[model samples]
Target: MQLQAYTFADTTEIKDLVTRTFSDSEGVDEGKLIGNLAFELLTETPEKDVFCFIAKENNAIIGCIIFSRLIFVRDIQVFILAPVAIATEFQRQGIGQKLIRFGLQTLKLNGIELALTYGDPNYYCKVGFQPISEQHIPAPLKLTYPHGWLAQSLTNNPIPKINEKPKCVRALAKPEYW
Candidate 1:
């Protein structure tokens, strides 16, 4: 399998992969929601505010992940990882984790300081994410599952404590997403 940066041609396949993977694990409705979310994050969001990555095997997209910039008043570079999905047939083979790691490494190489994500802490923990309180680094919106807020320093230093609430990219600004 090869990890690749997303291109316009990958849009349809990426959406289908996210939709089908979530439909298999979650319900069809949830699959649709995330699939739409991924599409918006790609097509609607500004290029400067988003990064998309994919895992492919023989030119077929098997998994995908997205990271959107989080703007804060203070000068700091941060991004949020979200809506990760791996094709149903490819799940449990570490493809998702590998894709995530590749995405994070790219972000780090580009000088990103902090990386945050909201999801299953147990799964995220394996990739260096730790439970982070909103008080430490406020999310764009009130979190429905506060405990799921996780973060890790992409740089060598620790994540700084910032009370200023950060704003997520337009595609991820919806209340339902927080």
Candidate 2:
């Protein structure tokens, strides 16, 4: 499979992929929830605030991931990974991890200081994520799974402490996602 940045023309297909993939794994309700989230992230977020990557085979998208800016009171450059999806058949093949690594590398090149994600610690830990506490970097919304709040510094410096909570994009502003 090939990893690359997503294009505008691929928006609908990407949304569908995320929806179908999540639905198959997490049930219909979750599939629709994440699908809508993906749609909003692609269509509503500012270009500068989001980065989307896809994994494809034979020109067909098989996996997708999104990273959106997490704005803080300070001028720190941080982004959050969320709502990743791999086609049901593509899971366990490492496509998700590869796509995430690609996205993180791209973020580092673009000068991102840190990356955060809320997800399965076991899976995310494979890609260098570590469990972080709210005291270290406050989340925009109260986290239901505080242990899943993870982060990694792209720079040599360690993850810094932020006095104020960060703000996510409108699509991820809801509490249910946090």
Candidate 3:
């Protein structure tokens, strides 16, 4: 399988992938949120921090992963990996895993650190993510999970110790809260 950056032509296929992934995990209607976020990443006004990658087999999209730039402390820049999706029939084929590993390697090669994500630690850990608490950094989500909400450093530097409450680091939230 060839992993490459997503193209405009991949829009519908990627949306379908997200819809299926979400439906399998959550429910049907709630699954649409992934597509909505994908739309925001592809078509919305904010363009600086969003990027996506797709896996192709025989020129057909089989999986996708997205990275959105986020802020932790005042000026710190980090990337958030979200909405990783593989076609239902293609699940457990290692396509999604490869997409994440390749995407992270690409981001690290570009000089990024502190990739954050809300996903199962088991899967993300296989790709190098450690629980946020085990590292010096902390999630800005102020949320908890049973092995969800993880972070990984791209470099050898220690992640900043975050004792202060985490504020939402991405997306719109209460102005004073995040």
Candidate 4:
């Protein structure tokens, strides 16, 4: 399988993969929520520094991951990776891992200093993520694991001190509701 920047043609396959994967997981029964999440990633503003990667095999998308800018008080460049998913049949094939590594490399080349993800620490730690703590970076929310609020700095720069929730201009919901 090859991991590449996602394209329009891969949208449907990505959607199908997400649906198949989430159907078995509890509390994720909302189809429109799934669709909106994908839209939020795909339509991310370049000025906001959001990008994505898709895993493909036999010309079909099997997995997807997203990285988006998280604006803090200091203009620090931090990215949040969310909703990494693999097609049910392709689980355990490392497609999701590949997508993440690829995206990380892509972001690092562009001088991004940090990457954050709301995912399993066990899974993400393999790629260098650790729990966000008061000593390093403050929690994005008061929330904690198995919710997977993890962070890793890709550079030597210290994680910025965040006194409050980062301002989020985009709603994760649909445009009509905004």
Candidate 5:
């Protein structure tokens, strides 16, 4: 498999890959829910505020990751990764971590200072993410599973404390998502 940025032409395939992957792992309803979320993230979010990467094998999508820009009171550059999906058959093969590392490296090159994600601490930690508290960097909304909030500094500096809450793109602004 190879990693690359996703293009508009890959829309339907990307959505299907995400939906099927999620459905296989989570449940049918969750698959549809996240599938719709993926579509909105691609179609509704401002072009400058979001980025997507994919893993393809023999020209077919098998994994995908989406990063949306986050706004904070400080002038720091930050992004939040959400709704990652790899083909159910591809799980535990390091594709997700590889995709995430690639995305982080690309973002760092473009001057992004921090990357945040809400997910399993054990899985994320393997990719340099560490559990972070709202006291250090507040999220855009209330986190139902606070322990899942995580972050890692792209730069050499440590994750800094922010006094203000961050703002996420409209597609991810809903309470249910957080």
Candidate 6:
């Protein structure tokens, strides 16, 4: 298996991977929603605000992850991880976790200070994510599952408290996604 940054040529495969994975795991509607979300995040978001990574096996995309900038009133550098997916057949093989680790490491190397994600805490915890309250760092939108709000400091320092609410990229600004 190989993990690397995604290129424009990988767009269709990435969207299909996410759509099919979510369809098999969640359902058809959810698959379409997240698949469309992934497509927009990859194609519409500004290059400086988006990062995409993929895991491939035998030259086929098997897993993918995306991180987009979260702008705050303050100057701190932060990004949000969302819409991660692993091919149905590849689930439970640690490919998702490996991709996440690689993505986070890449962010850290680029001097990103914090990483946030909203998802299953149990699964995210495996990758060093911890529950964080809006009081410490307010989310761009009201969270549907507050318990799933997670964050980690890439610099090894504690997650800092920021009173200002952050705004996510246009691709992730939909309240339905929160």
Q: Give per-residue lDDT, candidate 1, residue 24.
A: 90
By summed lDDT, which 10 consecutive residues of candidate 1 come out lowest?
A: 169-178
**What C-alpha RMSD separates each model from the true structure?**
0.8, 0.7, 3.6, 3.7, 0.8, 0.7
What is the TM-score of each predicted model, taking all chains together? 0.98, 0.98, 0.82, 0.81, 0.97, 0.98
lDDT of 4 by residue, 1-178 (tens): 8889887666667766766666655335654566557665666556446777888889878888877777777757788886677877898877777788899988988889888876678899888787775445554444435346678888876555566555333633233321
Tens digit of per-residue lDDT, candidate 3, span 106-159 = 888877876878778889889888776624555555544635767878878766
lDDT of 6 by residue, 73-163 (tens): 7888899999999998988998899999999999999999999999999999999999999898899999999999999999968999999
| 1-178: candidate 2 lDDT, tens digit per residue | 8999999899999889989998999899999899999999999999999999999999999999999999987788999998799999978988888999999999999999999999999999999999998998888999999999999999999888888888899999998887
- What number of clashing residue pairs does each candidate have, in the order they appear? 0, 0, 0, 0, 0, 0
Least accurate stretch of 10 residues (summed lDDT) in model 6? 71-80
Candidate 5 structure, TM-score to reference? 0.97
Residue pairs in collision within model 3:
none
Error of 6 at 70 (Å): 0.2
What is the per-residue lDDT of model 5 for residues 1-178, given as tens digits with 9 covering 90 to 100? 8998899888888889989998998899989988888888999998888889999999899999999999986799999999899999889999999999999999998899999999999999999999999998899999999999999999999988888998999888888888
Please give me the total number of clashing residue pairs in predicted model 1: 0
lDDT of 1 at 10: 87
The runs of at least 3 residues in candidate 6 whose Cα sits more than 4 Å from the true structure, single-residue gaps closed, are none
49 Cα displacement, candidate 5 (Å): 0.6
Please tell me which model should have the higher lDDT, number 3 or number 5. Answer: 5
Query: Candidate 1 residues 51-87, lDDT tens each?
Result: 8999999889999999999999889999999989988
Residue runs of model 1 more than 4 Å from their true location after superposition: none
The TM-score, computed over Cα atoms with residue i paired to residue i, of candidate 3 is 0.82
Instruction: State candidate 4's TM-score.
Output: 0.81
Model 1 TM? 0.98
Best by lDDT: 6
